[model samples]
Target: MEKKELQYIHSFEEYVNEFINALIAYSPKLISAIFILIIGLYGIRLINRMVKKIMLKNEFDPTLSRFLASSLLWALRLLLFITVISRLGIESSSFVAILGAAGLAVGLSLQGSLSNFAGGVLIILFKPFRVGDSIEAQGVAGTVNEIQIFTTKLLTSNNQTIFIPNGILSNGIIINYSLQGVRRADLVFSLSYDTNIKTAKDIVMKVMTNHPKVLKNPLPAVSVKNLTDTSIVLAIQPWAKNADFSSMSSDILEQCKDAFDKAGVSIQPYTIEASK
Candidate 1:
């Protein structure tokens, strides 16, 4: 019994000594890993700031700049974490392999989400449209409210909010109404054949020219478009700023109607013919 107790004490002492030696050997590496992590984090922040400044200087879109900075910062932090693990004597190859496997699994599960993210990246880079621009795409017409990673928010003219997936938006044809500062308002007005065409055209042109919103450079135009059985179709085209297009169109229509009524001009009412 005495010999057995001595052997146990001797084993315990050796184990303790080995643990202490290992701890001492690893302590400096642990400190170095921590120090590197701190410095790496600081460096990442500095790089992010610098990148943002450069992007701003280059007139990059604000949304794209923010997204790029965040992505870069996270990637750098991930690399720093892997480096710290390696410094602590962890096998980096297995760790990286595990990360790869996990990423693959996640990507497989969220294929649609990944596609949307890629689409968002493409949109930010290409700049098909910008926030506050009026756009028509995917069968919806609205002003771009926000551009997100997976979806875009649109505020429709009828005050409806739509969330369209970036994947579909990026692939579809986008009609940006606000890209051009000015837009042409094409309106067709019908007058009875008995009314003088020259007088009607003069009246329409005068109304358009007098309007505050209409642009004088292009010169508003009114011309006879077509002759029908009961009426003459006049095509009235006026140019106005995109922002004022809707209101200007409405105002012109109202003013034209009032002017024609006061001037004793008759507007023809359409009567659909029954199918023969």
Candidate 2:
């Protein structure tokens, strides 16, 4: 019994000595890993600051630059972590494999977000629309307030804010009303079938041409449109600056109504013909 006890204690002492030796052998590497980690952290910060300065010097877009900086920082940190692990004599291949698998799973889960980010990059690169532009997309018409990495913000006419995913926004139909600085208002007015068509058209044309907001360069004019059973359809086309389009439309209609009444031309409601 005494001999068996002595053997157990002797083995334990060997293990303890071996462990101490291993620790001693690993100390230099451990210290170097820590030192490299600290130095790498400082270097990362320095590189980040330099990159920010370059971006600013080049007048890069603020949101895109910030996002890029964050992505670069994380990527550098990951590389540093791998390097430190490799220096510690731990098998880095398995660690990297685990990280790759985890990254793939995370990427799969965030596919939609990734798509939005790609769309945002396209938008920022091409600049199809800018902030304050009036755009209609996905049946929503509003002024673009902010452009983000995953979504774009819009302010509607009623003051409601809409967050539209950039993925759909970039891929979908977008009508930018303010891009050309001018918009055409298709105004349809109905006149009594019996009234003289030429006279009524002349009156509308005179009113539109005289309006300050209406553009005469394209030449505002009235023309005969679809003829209904009860009335004649008159289409008044006017070009105006984007900011004045709404008010100009309203004013032209009101002023035309007064002009029509004074000229003794009868006005009637537009009637659609039934299908045969």
Candidate 3:
């Protein structure tokens, strides 16, 4: 019984010694890991602040600045996390391989969204259109309400909200109507064929020239554009400030009606087409 007890105590002592040896071996790795984590978190915070300052100094859009700053910070943090794991006596090669494979799969799945994100970034950086600007893009015409990372929101003339993907907007032609400082309002007036064309043109041109919003430098255009079965069509192009376009249009149409009546120019009747 004494021999058996001594043998059991010796085994326990050996087990304790082995455990201590293992712990001592891993202590340095644990310290290194803790050090990496602390330093990495500090570095991430510092980098985030620096990026924000740079973005602000460059006058980047608020949304864009926030997005870039957050993305960069998180990316740095992720790298630091991986490094910490490596310092903890972990074999990171397999983990890195797994992450690479997962990333490729995710990238493929999100290809379209990524494209839109990239396009949106380009739009924000280049500034093709600003909020409240009237623009035509992706076959939609409206006032830009907001520019997001993946999409653009527009308020239509008819008060409809439209959402267009940034990829389509960036790839296609963007017609910024507000950039010109002024836009031409195209007006077509149809008069009875029996009425004199020169008289009709003169009446329309006179009305356009008298409008307060009509620009005088570029000169208003009034000419016969088309001859239909029942009437002669007169085209009137008037340049007005962008903000005054709607007002000018309403005023011009009302003034033209009065002018036509005074000039004895008989307006033609309209016909509706049936769609098949």
- TM-score winner among the candidates? 1
lDDT of 1: 0.89
Tens-digit per-residue lDDT, 95-175, candidate 1: 999999999999999999999999999988999999999889998899999999999999998899999999988998999
The count of residue-pair clashes in candidate 1 stands at 0
> Over 4 Å off in model 2, which ranges?
1-53, 56-70, 73-92, 269-276
Quote the positional error of residue 69 for candidate 2 in Å: 4.2
Ranking by lDDT: 1, 2, 3
Q: Give the TM-score (vs. native) of candidate 1.
A: 0.82
Model 3, runs deviating above 4 Å:
1-46, 61-67, 87-92, 125-127, 271-276
Which pairs of residues have clashing backbones in candidate 3?
none
Cα-based lDDT for every prediction:
0.89, 0.88, 0.84
> What TM-score does model 2 achieve against the real structure?
0.73
lDDT for 112 (candidate 3): 94
Residue by residue across 1-276, what tens digits does model 2's lDDT show?
Answer: 699999999999999999999999999999999999999999999999999999999999776687789889999999999999999998899998998899899999999999998998888888779889999998899999998889999999899999999999999999899999988888888788778988998899899989999998788978998788877888888899989988898888888889998999888844412110
State TM-scores per candidate: 0.82, 0.73, 0.74
> Candidate 2's error at 233, in angstroms?
1.6
Ranking, TM-score, top scorer first: 1, 3, 2
Give me the runs in candidate 1 sitting further than 4 Å from their true place: 1-26, 225-231, 268-276
